[model samples]
Target: MVWPIDLAVLTLVVMVAIGSLMVKDLLGAAILFGAYSFMMCLLWTVMGAVDVAFTEASVGAGVSTVFFVGAVFRTSRRTRD
Candidate 1:
């Protein structure tokens, strides 16, 4: 099936990925990464890959994002510009 939504989600994923890498702030990067993961989940869902989408939602957006945020907060070292 031709999916216009997949293209949109892909575009959003790319933009979020680029923004995540470009940001200097650790917290912002983490949030952007989470957004990227969510977009990936959406893309997979659109592509009819429910298993992959669910995994991405749980591991990428959920556990990974939470881990990053928690680690950033727990760490004493500050991110350099």
Candidate 2:
């Protein structure tokens, strides 16, 4: 892979991560985290790690999102801080 592409992906991942962390809403953060996982899966696919990408896509994007949403529903959306 070329350096530019790698850099771009890395930048995207970092931006997503930062957004996830900075978001006050748990649901929004969860969605952004899922998006981060998807971008990471894309990067993995580009690196020829199909199996890992599949797992990340399934677990990170799907399962984790469900878990986060469920947790959010079980609790409150508002945060003190």
Candidate 3:
């Protein structure tokens, strides 16, 4: 690789990851998780791994997030503990 991933984008990814973990609402968590996946895709692209980026975009950012949101909508958002 000629260059490295930008620090700013990496920081944003970390923030989104933390936000996804910290959110109480399942829907909000799903959104943040999608954002995290997108950021990862971006980082992968920046690293010149187009195939990995595409796979992450389609699977992590697209299909998985949709599935998570759908499941979240079907279930109660509140925790049982």
Number of backbone-clashing residue pairs for each candidate, in the order shown = 0, 0, 0
Q: How do all models score by TM-score?
A: 0.88, 0.90, 0.87
Candidate 1 per-residue lDDT, tens place, 1-81, comes to 347887778888889999998888889889999999999988888888999999999999999999999998897325665
- Candidate 2, residues 30-73, lDDT tens digits: the string is 89989999999988887888999999999999999889989999
Error of 3 at 58 (Å): 0.9
Report residue 71 deviation for candidate 3 (angstroms).
Answer: 1.1
lDDT of 1 at 75: 76
**What is the Cα-based lDDT of residue 9 in candidate 2?**
93
Displacement of the residue 66 alpha carbon in candidate 1, Å: 0.8
Q: Local distance difference test, per candidate?
A: 0.88, 0.89, 0.88
Give the per-residue lDDT of model 3 (tens digit) for 1-81.
Answer: 334456677888999999898888888899999999999999888888999999999999999999999999899676532
Give me candidate 2's TM-score against the actual structure: 0.90
Off by over 4 Å in 3: 1-5
Give candidate 1's error at residue 17 in angstroms: 0.1
Better of 2 and 3 by TM-score: 2
Error of 1 at 60 (Å): 0.8
